[model samples]
Structures are given as C-alpha cells and as structure tokens.
Target: MTGGRLSHLAPDAVLTAARRVMARCDELARVTADEGAITRVYLSPEHARVNRLAAEWMREVGLTTRQDAAGNQLGLLPAADRDAPVLMLGSHLDTVIDAGRFDGIVGVLMAIEVVRLLRVADGDGWRSPFPFGIEVAAFSDEEGTRFGKALLGSSAVAGDWDDAWWELEDSDGTSLREAYREFGLDPGRIGEAARRPDQLVGYLEAHIEQGPELDRRGESLAVVSSIASARRFQLVVEGEARHAGGTPYDMRRDALLGASEAALAVERICSGEHHIIGTVGQLEAFPGAVNVVPGEARFSLDLRGEFDGERDRVWNAISRELDAIMGRRHLRWRAREVHSAAAVFCAPLLQDVVRAGIRATVAGAEPATLFSPAGHDGMSIGALTDVGMLFLRNPDGISHHPAESVAGGDVALGIRALAEAVAHRGAERG
Candidate 1:
C-alpha cells in the first residue's frame, strides 16, 4: 500500500472532503424506492428527491445548478472567462435493485468535492481559477433498472437518444414517456440535454472498482484503461412439448435440457478465453409445469471483452456451440441481439494525467492500470467527448449489491488524485 500525502493539499482538508463524501453517500442511500434496500431507479420520486438534494449541495458550493430535460442533475463552476469550454465530471445516480451505496454515488460526490478543493479563497467568497469551466453531472439513468434500457440518460447527453425508447415500459406497465411527464419533464425537450463537442473539454469520472482487482493487490486506486465492449442477446430454444411421463428419453426433444447445455458451454468457452466474459443471467422455460416437457426455453447472453473483434469472435464461437447443442437435441434455436456497445478507450492525454495524479498521491510505486469489465456512463459520454476514469478499491470486488464497500482513506486518496488530475489538465490547457 502506498502512504504519502498529496504535496499541494492539506491532509486535514483531504480527510474532511473524504468524510463529507461518505456522509453524503449515506444520506443518498436512504432516498430509495425499496424500504429496506437501496434501489433508486430512473424518473421515480426517489430520483426527484436526490436531484433536489444534489442541487442544494451544488448551490452550497457556489455552483449554478439545473436539472436537464433528460432529468440529469447538473452543476457548473465558471472559469475566469465564463464562456470557456467546460471540463465535465460525472457518473450515473440511478442504481440497480438492491445496489450498494457507493457504486455511482461516490463518483458524483467526489466530483463535487473536487470542485470544492479547486476553489481559491477571495476576501468574502471563493472563486474558480481554472483555465476552463467545470461541470458536474449526476446522470439520471445508467442501470436500466426500471426501463430495461441502460444508458438512457447519458445517451441523451451524447445526442444518441432513440425515439423508440419512449415506448419502453417498466414492470408497472408505465411507458417511459408517461413516466417522464409524471416526473415533470417534457420528453420532447430531451434534446436540450445534448452537449456539443465545442462546449466541452473532456469527461472524468471516479468510481469504486466493481471488481476486486485493487483490493486483492492491497492497492487503493488505479487508472482505468478502458470500458469493455459488450454484446447482449436473447436466445430461444424450441422443441415439441410432450407429456413428461409418456415421452421416452430417447425420443424426446427437450428444449430445457438443450438450453442448459448451451448455458454450460457458454461458461466453458468464455472461461477459456482471455478477457472475454459471458453470462446467462436470465433463463426461463415456457409452460413451466411438472407434468410437461418444456416446449421452449429462452435465455439471455451478455458477452463482453476488452476489444470488439475478440468479443464478437467469442460470440460466434458460442453461437456455433449452441447450434451443436440444439442440433444434437433435435431442437430449433434463434438469437436476437438486444444491445451492443463498442469499447471506450481512455484518451492517452487523460490517462497520462490520471497516472500523474495517482503518482502524486501514492508513495514509491508506479500507479496500476486496469481495464474495467463493467459498463459505465463513460461508454455513452465517449461519443461526445474524451473520457477517463479512476477506480477506488472495493473490498472483494462485490458490487451491484448491498455489500459493496470503499474505505474512507481510499476515498481521501481518490479525491486528492481527482483534484490533482483536474489541476494537471488545467495546466496543460494553459
């Protein structure tokens, strides 16, 4: 573990910022739809509550704040020249059902603290002195928990919002457009959230590593190399349904059995490949009954890799394997791609600054670099501007659950590293 104070920051101030971040995370955790767990989804009352709270915090720190038409909460710190292009910092505020408190919330809070740290004290008030303006965004949706479509909020910001998304519905049968109106936002005005490239510099986000890489190595932070490319599919296996008691073992075309074999093949093949991950997170059989052999089975496939070509290649392999399994079982199968996103590599300049930031905070060792396997808002934001990320160590790499954790000390280090990175970027622009 590295042990050293930031050369230019006061230890007490850093610690105080870290504490404030953690305390705010705790505060946000309580604003959830689920009574016993944290589950703040998009366009819900919980979302509105958090946005209001975030706006209040932004004002307390001297930022001009607004909720974008897409429902993303935004706050801006002006540069000496108010018209300067802005450097943006942000992460999603929405969470998966039963999510950990730190995943997205930590990043948004850390960005706020970074702004607080960068302000220079004037006679009666503080002022921003950076070469460019700074903006912090709390994206409304990233997990797709309610709409079943991830990155809706960021997609709007990146000018990629699809009109078809308005037809998407949640578990309660409420359409996205109706929900937007219910949440007091105009769906027609979502375009207002789009940010032009000329109005921005780049995006930087600090998040707790959703995996255990940092914690396993006894390190507190790492520079993110890239967000993984991903492809997702819904697969269906079809066969003739028959009475379970009457169907002979040798004559039966069992869809469930074939689907199970395909699932195992997915795990086996993906495990043999490097940086390629495949998950069958959802599966179901039609006419699920004890007395009937399942006539159809459907499952989801989420495939990801560090590179697009390799990920697609692995998917081809998995498809071939599925064909073999279905053929052997005398069943028919088909697949529909539900989602795909190319990998977003961090800009070299941003990576360099992140490394410098880590170097300044950690003592006597070079900073570690890791590619993120999980998807992030950066994946969408990359379409609009260059994106970079810093990861704080999460114990046991557990995320999307109640057990996700980050140490206060690591957060202190993260805030310092982020502030230093922003300062480094400012110097470069100057």
Candidate 2:
C-alpha cells in the first residue's frame, strides 16, 4: 500500500476523539510553578514527561515511537514500502505566557487522535488507505520560552545554524548552553537533528487562527496560502537636551518630534499595501526628567508583509520618512535592522488536500485561502521541507494573551482536515 490511500476519517468522529485526547493532555499541561491556565509551554522537565507519554500513546495505537536528540517526539508506523517516504503531521506544544487553553494544545493531540482512529479502523470499518503506516509528531521547543529565540528546534531540524544560535538566553539569563545541560540534551548533537530531505514527503501543521477571520464567518478551517515575513528595525533620534523653561521651541532640535513624524510616515505608507504593517512598539529616552528635554530618543520598528518586495517597500518608505524628519528637525538619526527573513508560501499540492478535507467535513462550508499576518513554526520548517498550515478559527481575532479561543466543532474540523492532508501524502508515497 502507498501513502496516498487515505481513508479519510469523518469530521465528527475526529472531533469527538480530539475532545477526549485534549482532556488527558490538559492534565499533563498544568503548570505547578504558575497554576494559571492550561497552555502548553515547553519546559525541559515537562518535555521529558511528554516524550515518554507520547511513546506510550504510540504503543497503545500500535505504532513504533521514539525521541530524537533535538527532543522531537515521533510515532511511526513503518511504511509497507520499506524505502517509502514518511508523511508527518505535527505542531509545537509550547505556548505564549498566560495563553488560552486551545492554542497549540489541540493541534498536537488532534494529530495523535486522528492517527489513532486510522490504525484502529474507527469501528465503522473506515480504514485509511495506508493503514499499514502513519506517523504523528510532537515537536519540542517551538515557543523558545526558556530562551528569547523563537522556532529553535525546527531550525535545527532544517540544518541551518550559526554561532549566534547558541548565544540565545531567557529573561533570567539562562543561555541555550545552560538550557541544554539542564534539560539533559547535548549542545554538540544539535547538528545531528537534521532530517533527510527525501525521507519527509511533506509536513502539515494544524494551528489556531489567532485571528477573527474564521469565527467572524462561522467557518472552521483556513487553508493558509503564504506566511508573512517580518522585517524588524530600530530608529534612533539624537537631539540636544536643554532646560524646558529656557529652551525655545524654535531653537530646539527635538528627537520626540522626529519620532512622531517618523511614526506618521509609517502610518501613511501602510495605506498603500493591504498586507503591510509597521509598528513602533517600544520607545526609550535617556536622562529623562520632568523639566529636561530628552537628549536621546529611540524606538523599535516592526514591519511585515506577504512578499519580500512589499516588506522592502515599507521599510524603504519608513527610512525615507525618517530622513525627511531628521532633515527638517536638524536632528541626527540612525536606522538599524535587527532581523530580516524572506516570506514563504505553503505547498499548493498539500493545500489542495486541506481544502478537500475541510469540504468533506463541513456541509456547504466554504474553505477560504487566507494569508497569516504572523509567522508559525511551520514557516521555519519551510527551509528544509514541503510544509502547509491549517488555521482554526479564533473567536476574538486576537492571540498571544488569555483572550484566544476556538469553537469545539471548528477545532475538530481542523483536525479532520489535517489528517486528510497527511493521509494524502502517505498515499502519494505508496
């Protein structure tokens, strides 16, 4: 049997199964240190516990399982075709601080439940086309909580690294080196985590929408077309600080004025591009006092878009505005780029499977192709493998806080759609 012979699970069945699995996962997800919500943030100690539990779950479902050096937990059903490729369904379990319960929790467990139904024949005699083998993964450390980095584990799996990668640390000053030692993982073996490009036919990640598109329309699954690249910059304005009472407005070279003008320029540029967004998230001034003029003023810039050209356009426009502001104010200013990443789109081949699965689950459900305003762990994996993502509807159209949500039915829909896509890849391998 090949990997593409997917006996797609019914949407309702996957939903019911997901609810059960989520309950168990939530128990394991509880934080002892901060007993707040049930969000799954990856901890070195908790990771070992989850890895062991996942292996047991694999055994219960009759699949072979193990953990890799990078702490990724994988459950596999050996392909009938000994040399056949693998179909992967996964998502990170970690979450943002004080996050909602469903963010990344459902995605990982949903994969497990879907694969379980396939191996067991769903009691309705609906067996997957490739019942001989299917796999689920609970990848480690996508959130990069212990360290300030994001998507660390996935980057290592893609075989891209630099000396700077190991230099990352958390707010408490725990470096990646210290994290590895504390977690019982080897920093030296990080390079060994890369997978053979040929071995993985495709990767599918089911994630929360973290936006209101789905809930607003009452839909369940969103087939994401592209992942936006976020270009980061910092603008610094240098001005002469003087006594507020003595310094005349006409004689002042004000950095705050430059900062405000640059901010307006960024706002104006956003009007031209629908997907482009720029934010001045942070601002700081030195020698601050009630009566003193700010000597040095600096602010952070965050810009993002679906294409590299669009990202560049917004950045250039912002720079143009900054230059104008500095010239007008007679103030010296500098712009520095903090980080840059190229935008990437998902595999259309797998996206087709996602659409089909959604349609099969929801009667008259219009499966829409939406672009993610933010990036995901899957985008990082795009460096090494063909990957696609499914977004479950978010109730509030917001995320990274306690307000995120998803309807039970919608979450179930995403799970079914993801399994269908994974099964399609398995069938293709055959």
Candidate 3:
C-alpha cells in the first residue's frame, strides 16, 4: 500500500479520513423519523437533511454539487474538458425502518473520501490526469421503504422510470405523485434525472457485506461477482373456520397449520440447495383469536439466488411442496408473485479493477470474490452502464437493524481500495 499506491496520503491520514466517514454516518443515522430509531424514507424531511449534508461534504472535496430531479444528491468533479466521459461512485442514502448506520450510507461517504484522496494526489487541485471526471451520487431511495418499489432514484438515472410508479402509495395513503409534489419535485420531470449511457464509463459501489460470508472468510473487503436475483410471493391458504373446541382433530382443515408446514417445507428445501435462500418473512392468520381455528393463512415468500433460472427452480420446488401439503391437508391455496428482479452480473473488467484496487490497498490480503444477496442501486444502474461492487465485512452480518457495524480500519482500507479502483479504471480506459 506504500510507494505511491495511495499518492501522498499516508496511512495515518487515510485512517483519519475513514474516521470522519464513520462519524458522518453516525451523524446521518440520527436524522430519522423516529426519535429512538433510524427510519429515514424516500422524500421525507430527514432525507432532505441528509442530502444537504452530503452535498456540503462533496463541496468540501472540491466537487460541484446539486440534487437531481429525483432528489438524488450528486457531486460532480468535472473533467479537464466539459464533455469528457465520467465515472460514477455512490450508494443510496435512504434506509429501512430502524435501519443500521452502515448499510448504504457508508458507501456514499467512502465515495466522497475517495474524491478527497484524489484531490490530494493532484497536489490539492481538483484536476487529475485520469481523463474521466468522478461523480459521487447519494441516491435517495434504494430501500423502497416508502412506496414498496426499490431503486427509484437510480432507475431515473438509468432512464428506467415507470409512469405507473406515480400511483404507488405508502402506508399513510400518500401516493408517490403526492409525495413528489409535497417534496417540491414534479413527477412529470422525473425523466430529467435520466443519464445517457454514452455519457459515462461505469458505476462502482462499496457497501457492507450484509451477510456472513466476508466475516467467515476473515476478510475486511471482497469484490462482488454478481447481485442475486429475487422473487417475492404472497401465499394464501384457505380453510373453513370453526370453533377450536368444536373442530375435531381428524375432521379439521386448518389453514394455519398448513401454512406452518409449508413454511417449514420451504426452509427444508432451500437448506440443501447451494446459494438459494427462501424465507417466509411475513405470516398472518385470520381471526387472530386464540380460541378460533384459523380460516385463512397468508404469508410472504422471498426467494433469492445468484442466478435467475436457479432462483426460479427453487421457487418451483417450493410451489410443489405447498401443493402437496395443501392437498394432503384438504386446504385450498393461492400463490401470487408480487415482485421479481433478474440477476445482475458485475462486468468482468470492472471486477478485475476492483480486485486490483484491493491488492494495491491491502498489500498481502487476498480479496474474496462473493455474490451479493441484497439488492442495491447498482441493479438499476446496471441497465445503463457497467457496475462493479466492493463489500466491506460486517462482523455480525447484521443489517436493517441498529446493531449493524463496520470496523474503522476497514473503512480506511475501503476508501483506499475504492480510490485505487477509480485510478485503475482511469488507466484501463486510457
């Protein structure tokens, strides 16, 4: 990592920058809806606060900052020429309910730190010999906590905005269009946020591993190979309601019991399959009374895999299991797919760059290559440009909760690795 691999910035200075990034993540974690927890959602007041803070940090790094029509805060360090190609680095800023501090916010802060390091390498000047400009974006809504549709900000940047999204509503009955108007953004002008593929090079993101892989491997960082494709389903089990005392064990058709068996079956089936994960994250029983035999059971099934076909294969297997259980239990069942996303493979060239960056930053450390099971803004941006990702180890593999964390030294290494990746891409392009 020495001998100019990181320019004039010494190890101590990098660590200092990393500390600042962590500090800022903590700061943003407080700007949430709930006083006792972090709950910032898309287009909320907290979202606006965080964007302004991020924009200020970008300006401190000598980048010109602005918030796009989609409310994504952007910092652009223009190239030597106004029309030169650009490289993008960022992650989303929004969070799920009671979210952790490091899930998406760490990546945005790390991107800003990369710009600061690059500015140092250029003799405290904003210009660098790297041909392409660097743009850091703090995407506003990747979590989809508000409208139930993910990647709103990045989808707009990728020119994939759907008009149908305007009708989407939140729990409080606020339509997406109404939210946009309330937030001072015109729904019709969302298209302005789109970026032409021809205008850029690629997108790179550094995020927490959000899984146990890196922690198990004893590594601080890893290069992402691909993002898992996912499918969501609403499964309903139907049976006649009867008094718990009146229903005899042999004659009863219990929907809740069938659903419980189905859930266990899903877990058992997915357990033996490599890289396939299935979960019944939400389950509900009708009547909700302790004395009543449930008449209906509803549950949500989320299935994910590194590849789309494989994920679907697992789904088919689960469906058969459900059918068999329902048939044996004399219960009727319904399955409705609510959402699905195809797998996104990281570009091979970009992955190589990321690996090279890790080597340059970590000295003798070997970068583990892993696939991400969680969705990210990259899924949308991948449609318009090549996308590469770096995963920082999460010691506990806990995210979307308050216990999410990252090591300070790990953040330092992540910043160096990301900056080196940018440099690597610049040289490759030349």
Model 3, range 89-172, lDDT digits (tens) per residue?
999999999889999999999999888888533446585446788899999999889998888999999999889889999999
Write one digit per residue (lDDT tens) for candidate 2, span 1-430.
1334344455567768767766755565574235676444444666677677767876676667777667788777655454666667777666666666566666777777777766644343223336244557777777655664567767777776565867777777777777777878888988887877777777788888867887778777788888889877777899988998899999987777778777778888886788897878778876678788877789888898988897897787777777887998889889887666678799988887777667655668478889987767676778877888888888878776766666666666666666666656555433
How much lDDT does each candidate structure score?
0.91, 0.72, 0.90
Which residue runs does candidate 1 get wrong by more than 4 Å? 1-8, 121-126
- Positional deviation of residue 367's Cα in model 2 after best superposition, in angstroms: 1.5
Q: How many residue-pair clashes does candidate 2 contain?
A: 13
**TM-scores of all predicted structures:** 0.96, 0.86, 0.96
Query: Alpha-carbon error at 128 in model 3, in Å?
Result: 4.5
* Candidate order by decreasing TM-score: 1, 3, 2
Instruction: Please tell me which predicted candidate would have the highest TM-score against the true structure.
Output: 1
Could you tell me the TM-score of candidate 3? 0.96
TM-score of 2: 0.86
- Give the lowest summed-lDDT range of ten residues in model 3: 1-10
lDDT of 1 at 265: 99
